[model samples]
Target: MTHIVDAAWQKILTTYGEPVPPDASPLLEPFAVLARVAHAEPLLRRLHPWTGMWELHFSRCTEMNYTWDLPYIGTLRDGRYYVEGPDRSSPRIAETDSAQAAVAMVVDRLPPGCGPAFLGNAGELAAYEKTRDQG
Candidate 1:
């Protein structure tokens, strides 16, 4: 259930106040709430931006696919890892031999004080700390 309240979509909803139809999938209920929040307060944006990273556990040609959390940073697709954020451009984290190594790069940056460890791409961990502390 990787439902994201995209900021871009929120802007459209705010400007036009469009009607959101009943979703056929119940799993999307949680996401709809977030969407509504975004639509109402488009400037609020995302407090926790690194929330929607997931992995496709299994994808069969004509069978039900499985999904799970990555528990790391960014997304891995087409044999490459990418660090994505709304405020920043999606940079290629790595294209290494070990998947674990790629994930390590992201995990190492999740905490505060990890300055320039990976180029401070995501607003420096300290910035996150300041907001967290204020909240």
Candidate 2:
């Protein structure tokens, strides 16, 4: 799953002709979470052509089966690159140069005052946001 991200990043660059400058690790955070969910959870119920962008079809979802398709960090036919976040209660679409910020967007999309996301801790989400803000 980790290795798949690099290839997806390459595709993002080729399609948009814009590689995320400096570093892509932060931008890839959401993708990492998607991979983790795929390995760790069994309730996720969706797949394919995430938000009509690059592969990494893994998408955002809740244990109850709610899901949202997203872009890992790529352009659509409209020529915009984004790492889209979940829209269960509301939607969040972010455009940024920092990979970490992209991760933060995903975290921010999480429902507030909730306990035990699929991973079972709010701090984990906070940690991702910390990385995003720090970057």
Candidate 3:
């Protein structure tokens, strides 16, 4: 089963002094856990478009899962943490520490307007923040 998060409705509640849905599951719970380990580090507190989603765009020229079952997270035989997104190319993120910190480093290093497109979801963003807190 899939979980849906009504972020816009929640925003309305906060702004209009309405009650939040008591049944609302914390959004991005599963994905955040994966993104935490996959991208490492978690969301940036100061970043704009603050949905806190962690996004990775794969090259169209590469051969791999473009969207589904992609962004594989694991260790090489040498014991380094790495994630292979839909691009089929593997990018090593960290070794001695959790990769979440590395993700933060990456986002920090991006030039203006050079960031990825998948990082805009608010639920995902919140999940990233939650992941950082848990780690």
Candidate 4:
């Protein structure tokens, strides 16, 4: 069967140039934790930086339906994937066609309270890494 984590695994391989542990290729704990703590305030702020302040109200709808105030990022039509890390030097890619799914996947793999800072833009993500590398 095709696995959602395959693509994320491929990404990890390409980025790290190494193979992941068989059982540890995709971490699942963080995702579950994040799901439990899912809320819109922080996510909304991260997703929309230009707005001064915003309010989110859950409404019944299809495309943009949310239980919280965060914007719709995207859904994973083909399931989802994940990657976990203690790698402090990893580069964070801020944009993807399936950014929502991707973030969920990564969250699944991460440890609780280990959320990465969403830089709000591609340039910001890049700059974060560049600055980290320089130090």
Q: Give me the candidate number with maximum lDDT.
A: 2
Give Cα distance to truth, residue 114, candidate 1, Å.
11
The residue-by-residue lDDT of candidate 4 on 46-76, one tens digit each, is 2211100111111111122211212222222
For each candidate in the order shown, give its overall lDDT on alpha carbons.
0.32, 0.38, 0.33, 0.30
Candidate 2 vs candidate 4, lDDT winner: 2
The residue ranges of model 2 lying beyond 4 angstroms of the native Cα positions read: 1-52, 55-66, 69-81, 85-92, 113-135
> lDDT per residue, candidate 3, 9-66, as tens digits?
2332243243335663333233233333432222321222111222332211111221
lDDT for residue 62 in candidate 1, whole number 0-100: 14
Worst 10 residues of 3 by lDDT: 58-67
Which candidate number has the best TM-score? 2
Q: After superposition, how far is residue 19 of candidate 3 from its true place, in Å?
A: 29
Q: Which candidate do you rate higher for TM-score, 3 or 4?
A: 3
Q: Please state the error at residue 126 of candidate 2 in Å.
A: 26
103 Cα displacement, candidate 3 (Å) = 1.5
Per-residue CA lDDT of model 2 for 1-135, tens digit only, reads: 223333443443344344445665443444443343333322222221132424233333222232343334443333323554443343436665544454444445435432222221234445665797899
TM-scores for candidates 1 onward, in order: 0.26, 0.30, 0.26, 0.22
Q: In lDDT terms, how accurate is model 1?
A: 0.32
Which pairs clash in the backbone of model 1?
none
